[model samples]
Each structure stands twice: as C-alpha cells, then as structure tokens.
Target: MVHSSDVCQCESFIRYEKTFGVTHFYSIEGVPRTGPTNVTILNITKHSALVKWTEIAAEDRLGFLQGYRISYTDSSRKKSPAVTLNASVTSYHLTGLKEKTTYRVQISGFTNAGEGPLTLSQPFSTPKYDKGELEGFVIGVCFSMTLILVFAPLTCCLVIKR
Candidate 1:
C-alpha cells in the first residue's frame, strides 16, 4: 500500500507491504527549491569566456548551497560535462574553445534538494585572434630587408669588398 500527501504543493510518499509488513517514508528536506537567475556572459576571448549568474532566492535556499552546474556545446555539437563550482562562486571562466565559433551554454543552481531547472540557453562566440602591431612590424621589416638586399649588391659592385 502507498499513501501520498501534498503539503505546500510538495509531495510526500508512504509505502507499506502486506507480505513483508514494512513501511517507508520519503519527503523533501531543507534545500534550494528554485533555480538561479540572470545568467550572462562576459569578457569573451578567442579561447575563453567568463560567465556570471545571480544567486538563488534566499528563502528558497534552506541554508547552505552545494554549488552550481554549467553545461555547454559548441558548433561541432559536442557537449561538455557539467562544470561544478562552490556555492560562493558566481563567475566561472570556460576555456579551450575554437576561435570564431559560437557556443551554446546553460546553467543551473543546486543544493541538498537537487539540481533545479536550467537557465534559458545563451550563445556566445569567440572572436578571432588579432596580431595588429606585430603584423605591421613584420611588413616594415620585410620591406627594409628587401631594400638592403637590392642596394647592398649594387653598392658592392661599385665599391668592391677588396
């Protein structure tokens, strides 16, 4: 036999068996009842990004939080394992990403209860790496080297190294 009751919309279950004559009870305990909010991406780079999110509501969270879990997928459709972090942390840095590719990300808050609903999905793209000043320097050096190679031989023929 099984008996169920609803308290504050939370479910409680009781089970009993006639043959074995045993009873068991299960119910929710102190834990976070809702998911975190306001997940955002910041400080994007060619191979990494910083993610931030709001904390769970105070009342909904019983006392201490376990942590958070983050999941991400890239243009290649490869899924990443949920990254876990301490409860005190709100920002996380994701690394090892392909340049100029968009990654889809989702986050969820967890506590003693379990993982809550995932946040609304968000997509962010890594920008291409820039070698601005280095590129210009290389071009200038090449031009100077070419000029030396051309002028040095002509000058050498006129004013012999003898």
Candidate 2:
C-alpha cells in the first residue's frame, strides 16, 4: 500500500553544468541542503557505534529532502559502507565495528538537486570487548526454551490430528 505523502514531486529536464556538458536528467526534484549541522556519536559499543544528528536548516534545503547518506571509516578499510536512511530519521546504530577501534564518520543529505555537504566527524573509537560471562548466555537459552516449550505443543496439536 502506498500513501499520498510517499509520492514524490518530480520533473525531468536536461541541464548543463558549468564545467561539464549537458547531463542526463530524469525525475529531478528539489534536494536537501548541507546535511547534519551536528554529527554526534552518542555511544560506542564493542562492535557498534550509535550516531545521532540534527539536520540542516530548512532554508538550506533547496528542494525536498529525500534521505541521507551516512559513512564512516575504521582501521580495516579506508572507506565504510554508506548507509541510506530516511530524512526524518535523526539517529542510527552502526554495527560490525571493530573493538577498541577509532573511525571517522561523515554525514550528507541528498535531494532532487544532488548530494549536499559532507560533515566529517571527529575520530571516535569503539569500546573494548567485555566478557558478559555466562549470565547473558544462560538467560538467552532459558528465554528461547520457554518460548519453544509453550509453542511446541500447540504446533504439534495443529499439525498432527490425534
């Protein structure tokens, strides 16, 4: 199901850049302004980092904001995967980070116009891995077992008519 709000306002035209010649144009709309006036790393877990940020002022958005591109780098690679998020979303969790590793993060927005400014964040490191001990493992198994015990009987009764 699609909603009216989800429908985008778009147009098509060929425009020439100052340096480059005419470029292909299709489905062009207004684009967001410089993204993320403030890029903050809220928390750094052993294998993840939680990032939060506020968007640029509305006036900066020349066109409607479609979404954002969040990128960061760690020790293993010079570049990280770009995560695309909705414009309304102001926070995100970055997973698969290395333990006790620092990373440089950047945030940019995209609109009908194109990609906006990239806000490079200060280097931040993931937290050291802490052995959670048997407490977490035991609790997880117990929880799974409880659910299976409760559902297994109902599933068997429905499947095998005795």
Clashing pairs in 1: none
Best model number under lDDT: 1
Candidate 2 residues 1-162, lDDT tens each?
111232233434224313334233334455564677777887677788788888767667766778889988887757987999988998899988888788888899988678888886657887665357457888899999999999999999989986
Model 1: per-residue Cα lDDT over 60-98, one tens digit each:
565457888899999898998879998888889999888
Give candidates' CA RMSD values in order.
Answer: 11.7, 16.4
Single out the weakest 10-residue window by summed lDDT for candidate 2: 1-10
The runs of at least 3 residues in candidate 2 whose Cα sits more than 4 Å from the true structure, single-residue gaps closed, are 1-31, 131-162
**Each candidate's TM vs. the true structure?**
0.63, 0.59
lDDT of 2: 0.76
**After TM-score superposition, what is the CA distance of residue 21 in candidate 2 from its true location, in Å?**
41
What lDDT does the true structure give each of the candidates? 0.78, 0.76
